[model samples]
Target: MSTFEDLAELHIAAEKLLMVPAADEWLLRGSDRRLDEAKFRKVMVDLLSAVNRSVGITGFVELVRQVEATADPVTGKVSPAAGAVVLLALEQRIDDSVLEERISPIMVVLSRAALRSMNAERELIGLEPLAVLQKAVIPNEEILFREMFPELAVSVDGYMVTAVGSHAQAITPVLVNAANPASPMAIGPLQRQLRSQVADLTVKRATMIARTETARVYGETAKETQRTNGITRSRLATAGDPCPICMEEAARGFLSIDELKPIPLHPNCRCDWIPDVENWLPPMPEVVQA
Candidate 1:
């Protein structure tokens, strides 16, 4: 359990110490992957060339064909590009497990502090301190990854399409210039596109997952501790620039312990829970829900 002030502090620390930094790391790692732009461009070009005999035929005909793969409805042929993207992204992908590992350091510190908080509260209330902190179990990631890879492929395939269309417009000479390792043309825009999309979409998804999981950990841990001590209510604190939905949730002061976890109204929510403390909050002015 935490005071509202304590919850605010936790929320701030998680953002500064965990989410933004992790996003930057993921963006950079997922984009260049430690390779220089020229080298990375060459690598992608080579992969494309291998797939479709050469960059010329590949970028123009092959990419268009793949995009229009289901054009023949009766036969219903699968998109080859989709299949390729799935395999490539899977071969070098970061799923929930990787994200968990990335955020675990901060999570561990936060969870320990929470455990201590629960213990202190119990002692104050003349109850026994918890013997052990409950550990959150890692689910079967292989099955999860199997479900996720195709979704990632959908995005990566789009990025490939972007590379084909941007700057070069799938023309042979321009693409060949891009394929050249020294003084590459058209690759810079493609590289920027890859980095931009991954940073914007993938990083956002990862950040959402991170925050949601962290809130789950907080909620579950607090729920158990509160149940043990016969406490029944909690509060959610809004941090950063919150949406109207969040304002509404926050306005419902000292809600039931069941909703103790931060339930994000949308992705990248910055709301967090205070511990199961009763009637401590003054009434908040209600906001009209949309």
Candidate 2:
């Protein structure tokens, strides 16, 4: 089994590789570019605005806010995926709108990594174990990183286990002195505050992108496939009971006992479990915000 340190190293490497182009783009922002650059840059900004507005639900919105607070002001590093996508469009130098053209690739890389990782884990452990891991690991980040830095081939394997401890410490809020919405007269101040926060998010995005790409480029090989042909020798093992978190019956024929991997029994979950499983284990619990 892979260690968390091993996975963290890979993540760091991936980030570094993707960072170069992102940093370069930031440096070249006001420099010469054909009409193409101007057009796409506008599109990129629009897409980013849309992404912020539609970033999951309330929790995710708050998460973005927190990320922005700590992110570098100059780089706008709140979410690396944004930078990766922009870099991708810039590289193509395509005249098309960056958002329409780039969102798919970003989504594709994220989805593929997720499915492939789950499939591999399913074959190695049991379908239940894999499902639990899927709830835990979240391959989207790795995929986003790799796609932004295609030259750096990344695969999602042990990122979940490594991400758990870090995630615990990573949830600090990005404080913003948001203007009082009730005071309509403060509109200008509110806009300025929002702009600052948005800038922070941009930097965070760039940093994550760099880490993911670097890891993919110079990291250890991902498991080719835990099983052959995607066919498990045994049926997906089940718990024969309802999952505590979802309250849905655990599908029959999956692996894992109830106590060790109880709630949030699927992969990429937001819930908690007591004794976390190895590489693809569920999280311990969310910290209570003060």
On TM-score, the candidate that comes out on top is 1
Give the per-residue lDDT of model 2 (tens digit) for 1-290: 22233333333332222221124443443232232234433534544454334332243334344444445555334346533332343223323343344444433333333333334434333433334334423545435444443554333332322332222122222222231122222546544655665555444533222123333322212212222223222222232343464343333333333222332245222222111124553234469999
Instruction: Name the runs in model 2 displaced over 4 angstroms.
Output: 1-44, 52-102, 105-185, 212-214, 221-290
List the candidate 1 regions with Cα displacement exceeding 4 Å. 1-86, 89-129, 133-177, 180-207, 258-262, 276-290
Candidate 2 CA-lDDT value: 0.34
Candidate 1 residue 282 C-alpha distance from true site, Å:
22
TM-score of 1: 0.38
lDDT tens readout by residue for model 1, 64-137: 34334333343333344544443343323223333233232333333333444444445444566644432312
Worst 10 residues of 2 by lDDT: 267-276
* Cα lDDT for residue 77, candidate 1: 35
Whole-model alpha-carbon lDDT for candidate 1: 0.41
TM-score for model 2?
0.25
Best by lDDT: 1
What would the TM-scores of all predictions be? 0.38, 0.25
